[model samples]
Target: MSDFQCHPKPKRLTWAEAACFMVTGPTAYRQLFGWPGNVVKPGEVVLIWGGAGGLGSMAIQLTRIAGAIPIAVASTDERAKFCLELGAEGVVDRTKFDHWGRLPDTTDEAGMNHFHKGARAFGKAIWEILGTRQLPKVVLEHSGQDTLPTSMYVCDNGGMVVICGGSTGYNGDVDLRHLWMRSKRLQGSHASNFREYREVIKLIDAGLLQPCLSACGTIEDVGLYHQLLHENLHPSGNMAVHINATESGSTELA
Candidate 1:
């Protein structure tokens, strides 16, 4: 049978790494290069939400490869370290702030003030990491309700916020005043196409990218793994199960 999905494995990728690369790698590549109209350019800043997970890991390296500055948002020290190891210019500890969810209406002065204070602090954190007052040209977003408002707020004028999933709640708010006044773009993308996938594979083959898989387990641990993931206790990067083989790649990294 002819299979379009089959591609020659990269020289540096193991079977487990290949599995990790196939999805997140291509999706990330397209997000930075093809999907968004405001694609990432060299030397531009790119803010990536969930920067320690499967997609975020790929986004970090891909952004680095593209010559863009990548700042990752992570919740823990370990996760933040993982992003840094993957070449993120900086890592934001999301747990430090609490201003999340929908932006409060203008009528609620107290709520708005609290939100603004937290949001500005978070934005300032980005500036601190960057060592300058510039904003991100592109925001890689999979987080939805909790971070979208801030992403829109800190994105550079006429920048793009490209999203693929909502691991968090789906109700996200975009502050239209800044969005319209600054001419920002919010673009939605799905899984990558063949060309995108092929490019990722080639990059892996040439050693310009890594799979960044964090762990592997037997099929019996699927329930436990999913539980860990849902509870946000899973390791950084991709996690895979040994379907028919005894082992595949590095078993743990978090």
Candidate 2:
């Protein structure tokens, strides 16, 4: 392991909490701030794709701390509630929309119209939450193939959609017109560097960020967990498994 990989846990955090945030926090940070030509500015609207998921959850907190408004796209009402609880300015229930997936060719009138209609409605949903016509300045993307086009459609002009992983599929459709005409960017990102990791931990240490640990399991459950994740049937929020780490005598007697 490299020296940059090791981070000290803040005393106020449980092992589960620290572990839950260790990866997602920095990734989210990098998505918002570390990416080229896509740094999130104060008061910007950041639309997070997986609002209740691990990355989305952390992005919401980091966005707020950066003086930006965070809106989350969630699948369920329960998840929407969770996002709002985490200080999301708004949460859009993604289940209502059916126009996700690869885009049709530009000349395909019907397909393009239907897709545009649905995308506009999606943007309207965000406007409804914001009480304004302004769209997200930065869209945090992970569901690649299905939602990428819509993300491009709704993002504000000159804004960016920073993508980390493609959970839905790899082949996301992008209209080059959106790039040259609107001056928008679709940026790809991955894990953050050590500086980004340490910055997020500083937020945790300052009590500004909450580690949203949804579940904890043992080493034996890792396989089952990954299977559930692949099927998208796992519980929301981040999960942690203790590997060679014992919980015994770790908590103070209260």
Candidate 3:
């Protein structure tokens, strides 16, 4: 009667699952920042600071599909290995490098000097991987806090840094002079629109974009979800927190 036979009701996904795809798939990959064509080229290395997270996991896969080498930076060795298994060409250990505030001495001329020198060294390593004396052409910023400056440091002249969330506090001091001089671009990306969303689903359905779904939890345990995220307990990759509205409870996936 109402085209029921031709168009049956589509399956509905839970909020957590939907959030996973929205952040990691084509919207972030294609529409929001217009990746592949907009961001990277074949053989170029795209450094994703939070490669093991939901959005970062998606970025790594998309970048690989787009024909670029994905260099994922993880907080630990286990996560780095996991990202490599998920298609990353290389991995950087965040723990190895010292961030701005995390410098040895909290306050002193020596500490400040060490921080500056560390920043330069970090920039140099990144540039070497990019095959130029400049930073990467495309830098995906997902770590939110500690790695923000790294994004600023590793970006090449005319490069773009796509800012998503600030898991860490957002405010910080950066060298703006280099940004202006290099003509680097800092762009903020959010969830994709309906059209892009559908495209992402298609990629998943076709098995072209396989994001790592690390963990799953029920909705009633939302507090646990936040706790895991805040504490960095969740494994690097896509972690799903499932909510059974009907049962009014949640459970973590094995």
lDDT of each residue in 1-254, candidate 3, tens digit only: 54322221113433344445655665457522464434677776677877777777887888887788777778788888778887887677767776544324435778667767777777666655556664467888755556666677677777787776667767634557768998877777776665666667766656677746666666666688778888988777666665444431222222
Best by TM-score: 2
Q: How do the residues 1-254 of candidate 2 rate in per-residue lDDT, one tens digit apiece?
A: 77866887877877777788888999999999986666898889999998888899999999999899999999888888989999899999899999999999999999999999999999999999999888899999999999999999999999999999999999999988887799999999898888999999999989999888887888998999899888777676788887776662253322
Error of 1 at 23 (Å): 1.7
Q: Let me know the TM-score candidate 2 reaches against the reference structure.
A: 0.95
Model 1 residue 182 distance off true place after TM-score fit, in angstroms: 0.5
Q: Which regions of candidate 2 are displaced past 4 Å? A: 248-254
Order of models, best lDDT first: 2, 1, 3
Best by lDDT: 2
Pairs that collide in candidate 2 are none
Error of 1 at 221 (Å): 1.9
lDDT of 1 by residue, 221-241 (tens): 899999998998999988877
TM-scores for candidates 1 onward, in order: 0.94, 0.95, 0.78
Question: By the TM-score metric, which is better: model 1 or model 2?
Answer: 2
Single out the weakest 10-residue window by summed lDDT for candidate 3. 3-12
lDDT of 2 at 148: 96
TM-score of 1: 0.94
Off by over 4 Å in 3: 1-19, 30-38, 102-112, 127-134, 245-254
